[model samples]
Target: MSARRFLPGLVVLCLGAVLARGIELVLGANHLLVAIGLGFVLANAVGVPDRLEPGIATHKLWLGAGIVLMGASLTLDTLLEAGVVVVAVIALVTGSTIVVVELLSRNVFGLADRLGSLLAAGSGICGVSAIVAVGGAIRARESQVAYAAATVLLFDAVTIVVFPIVGDVLELSGTVFGIWAGVSMFSTGPVVAVGFAHSDVAGQWATVTKLARNALIGVVVLGYAGYYARSADGSRPTVRTLWDEFPKFVLGFLALVLVATAGVLSPDQLAAIENAYNWLFVLAFVGLGTEIRLTELRKAGPLPVLVVLIALLVASTLSLATLSVLL
Candidate 1:
């Protein structure tokens, strides 16, 4: 709780963020990915000092804060403007992806329940953020979280390029391509990048659709929490217990959305908040990257990747087909 206790890790995270920004500027790579890559190299190749461990462990705090602040960017007006058809498609695709991933992970692949849930959340929702949120809600192991995250990142890398190519090959419209990518992609960054690679209008549509999916994170997380709680005890979770298991940051996220909807934040203020959350996410991902060990990740084998691939193919194909008809 003391500032001194966290100072060492915070210093490392800040330095990592600066280095990530430098890498981004020089190489034009995604800063979030760069941050994680830096942390992974430092931790695996160089090694984190024992003294810095405690502070670095506070990455979860940073993650929670980032999620809460990210709420300011998700005004209700944007969702409404995306239109009812887009909203319905987003919900349907998101929900179906989660269910398919969960079933494949648990029934077919024989993954542990929590690990499967983590993968489900990652595939079905906003990628790493959803994985982390659901991991916390379900009390999943760090190894599992890392494994799920790595899989999502892998897909993010692949799909960013592939989606653009597919869009061109299919001669899809910008609106259809954007909505398809928004519904099917693993992460927001890749979704936006893929969308814009097609056209400006596609980029805007992708961002809105992805935002709608992102808004469902809290709901999916809570649902998992309740299910896990009940399965652990063989009884329905009481309100008190469910409340205790709830991620409180979600409440803050919702509150910020309301405030932003009411026009309480000026554009400049909202931009500032966005910048803050982006930095927080970078710092948190650095810490997450450090926690990932090659040995531990290897224990997960290739099943997670296979599960994700199947889900992605199904989700992307189905969403694209559906969008062609709807849009």
Candidate 2:
């Protein structure tokens, strides 16, 4: 309720967004990436002053809200258009990444199972969101969750820049690059950014593929919750448990998707919604960047980072192979 804590943080975020826009106009940079880079520099170089901490904390809300609104872009026909093959590729990539990351964390890296699972979920599924969800399900330490989030952020920045270049160098077709981007990316925004930055066809395919991946977050989280419940307390999971654990924001996305499908909103209205989601997403990403404390990541040691890197490489390699077969 105090303005001192919230207002300062809000102002800094606005400044970051404005700066990102300026970079986009001048350099044709990806504004989301710029916002993240700007926030990282501000945080690491001079530190985000303590007064603005509260508003920065609100970024999670922004991330959720923005993602929900992003549902406006999805419709039933588009969803169906993604087809069975694309869905199969996504599932394969996700399952493979998680299994490989967990195995490496346990056998190769010699980390605890809880920490290993958190890292695996983050890298394999939806980055920070999946890490936080699975971490809670498995009762992972807060420190472990932070480390997993940081590790994903590191790759998020790297892949954001590198994916486009790799696609171009390989002269990848739009469909191939789209599948690759959707399966390999841990988050939707970066997938959209990289795909669109390359070509329109790639962007369209990426959005559908990524959304399909995102929709499975609830299923994946419920599975983890059930797995841990039976192991820890010997309680079998039930329908109620799955309902309680489901991500509500996904429902919001689905509602908006129905609205889109029903043709309830005019084109202009949908455009405005799209614009709103972009702003919210950029703001959330800026907050995410500021929250990353490099010191904590360093404390996480080499194993977790190595596991994430390897998992990413595996995901990338596997998705590429899948694209070869499908495309």
Candidate 3:
């Protein structure tokens, strides 16, 4: 709990974030992805010393803070502007993706129950954050958490490039492409990048849609918590248990949304919050990249990958078709 324990890793993350920004400036690449790549290279090629591991582990804290701050960039008005139809589509796609991944992972891939749940939450909600939240809720093994996170991270990297290319090929409008990426992509960073890659309008839509999905993380995690608790004890989870497992950062996010919707923050203040969240995400993702050991990912084998692939393909194609018709 001491600051010293986290200082070393925080320093590394900060430096990595700064370097990612520089790379973004010079090469015109997405800073978040660059941050992840830099962390991966350092962890895999250069190697992280044992002394830094404790601090690096705090990346989740930074990620949670980033997400909460990001809420300032959105408002109820923004969501309302996206239309009730868009909200309905986001809910439907998110729910369906979770169900499909769970079914495929269990019935077809034959993965462990906890691992399947981890993948389901990751694919259905906010990627690594959701995986971590649900993993803890279900008391998943560390290996299962690692495997699920790696699978989601891999897809996030892949989709960042592929979605934009697909949008261009299909000649989809910005709104359609943004909603598609937002609904289908594994993580927020990649979805945002892919959306902006199409157009600013697309980026806004993508962020809003993705946030809608993200808002469901607490409910999903709570459900998993109760299910796993009941499975373990043959008794329902207590109110205290569910409350303890709830993601408090989600409350922070929702509060910020209310504040923003109330017009409490000036445009300058909103911009500042946006900048803070962006930098926090860069630092957090750099830490995320460092955690992804190629050997660890390889241990996940092919089953989980196949499960996600099938789910993504089905969910994305259906979402695209629906958006094309609706939007």
Query: For residues 1-327, what per-residue lDDT tens digits would candidate 3 score against the true structure?
Result: 688987898899999999999998999987777887888898999999998998888887887787788778778876677577677787888888889988887788789988999998999998988898777767788888989998987787678668878999999998888888888998876776577557757876786678777777778877887788767532344567556645567688888889988989998998899888878878888887886677666665688888988889988998988887777
Per-residue error (Å), model 1, residue 238:
3.1
- Candidate 3: segments with Cα more than 4 A from true spot: 105-118, 128-150, 164-178, 187-207, 217-235
Candidate 1 local accuracy as lDDT? 0.78
Off by over 4 Å in 1: 83-87, 102-122, 125-233, 320-327
Cα misplacement distance, residue 118 of candidate 3 (Å):
4.3
The clash number for model 3 is 0
- Say which prediction, candidate 2 or candidate 3, comes out ahead on TM-score: 2
**Which pairs of residues collide in candidate 2?**
none
Q: What is the C-alpha RMSD of each candidate to the true structure, in Å?
A: 5.4, 3.2, 3.5
lDDT of 1 by residue, 131-205 (tens): 887787777888889888888877775675678789889999988888888889977656755665576577657
Q: Model 2 — TM-score against the truth?
A: 0.83
What lDDT score is found at residue 198 in candidate 1? 73
Q: Against the true structure, whose TM-score is highest?
A: 2
Q: Where does candidate 1 clash, by residue pair?
A: none
Full-model lDDT for every candidate = 0.78, 0.78, 0.81
Better of 1 and 3 by lDDT: 3
